[model samples]
Target: MTIRVADELLMFLPAARRGPVSRVPSDGTSTLGHLVESLGVPLPEAGPMTLGGEPADPSTRPDPGAEVRVASVPRPQPVPLEPGQVAPRFVLDVHLGTLARRMRLLGLDTAYHNDMDDPALVVQANEERRVLLTQDRGLLRRRALWFGAYVRGSRPDDQLRDVLDRFAPVLRPWTRCTACNGELVPVDKQEIERDLEAGTRRSYDVYGRCADCGQVYWRGAHGGHLEKIVHEATRQVEAAGVAK
Candidate 1:
């Protein structure tokens, strides 16, 4: 029997059970929903499935020659940011190396390890309730991840913008170590003189210390450049208004 399946729904079956709609076997029967999922699309992304213009669960089996339709779910809107609240934390997979650095520079709570395996990334994200950011589609598809994003661009600046637009976190510039996402603490200039270059010591009197790794920071020649980058990245988000 020839199955006249709807164009909207994609079908999949075990290799032995698979056949073209024009060649659908009389013995083969499966729900429009199951058929769509068998093609690799997640259920969450699939909207209502229908047969003959009536609502049909993916589990509802259809006879051969039945018409099936699968609709897609609408994309979700970005959640509003909470103001006067701590920023949402993130865990980036190994592929987002530059983005992790940029996020840390902007003082977002971000965790990154260049050598993190995919399984470890899933575990960390689930345990910490951290948003998982990755370039891998498989990682985003993990069931344990409540929040995740598939980075759309390869450029660091564009990736930064994509993250900001997706999750508008409260920006607190200069509050984290760009190299290690550690909290920054104010330190006395005289206390860390040996760590400073001669020219840096001669020019700057103020500094901040990283609480976790004891890294020292100062407003050196790079400060202005960093500040500008942070400012530009966060300006639009601030203008959009975060929740208080």
Candidate 2:
């Protein structure tokens, strides 16, 4: 049998097959879904398929000499989230601490606790309906997980870009606490006055606090730095064509 992949979905195809449609040895009876996974693309990542130019589901077995075409998941994907997750919320395993922090910087609802075990992470994902974001393919292979993605990049920047490209979560800057996965709300100066140092009290009037942790925040000297990152992340997500 022969295989062809859409340009956007090519990355999921095997390396040599990634550049163009290529011929493949086929089992006379295996389902198209099995063939897709055998070639390295996960079932969830696989989209519509066609055999011999006719519409087909991933479950359909191809006929002999059938030229199959595979497409990527349709964007904006259907991912679960917490009630207010304008973009999908996330649950990261221990390895993604840096990425989690970076996501929180963009005001995304990302849950990352270094102490969580694999079982706990899976349970949390199911209970909270948050997408599991991990580099481990084994975890992504779990059938109980309703939503997830395999992070292919080793660097934090590339990981972030991959996430932005794949999920297209809406950017909500300064709306979440980077220290904790908590929502941020404006707090009047006098309300959190007891928590502030004299320098903080005198230097900044605008204040915000984490609804869950009660951690205080203000637009202090680092505001510009935070703004810069927010702008950069927003630009990247936009360039990825997923920003709403």
The top-ranked prediction according to TM-score is: 2
lDDT (Cα) of model 1: 0.71
Candidate 2 local lDDT, 55-88, one digit each (tens): 8987788866889998877765667655655788
RMSD of each: 6.7, 3.2
Query: Top model by lDDT, which number?
Result: 2
lDDT of 2 at 38: 70
Model 2 regions more than 4 Å off: 6-25, 78-85, 236-244
Per-model CA lDDT versus the true structure: 0.71, 0.81
Name the TM-score of candidate 2: 0.80
Model 1 error, position 64 (Å): 11
**lDDT of prediction 2:** 0.81
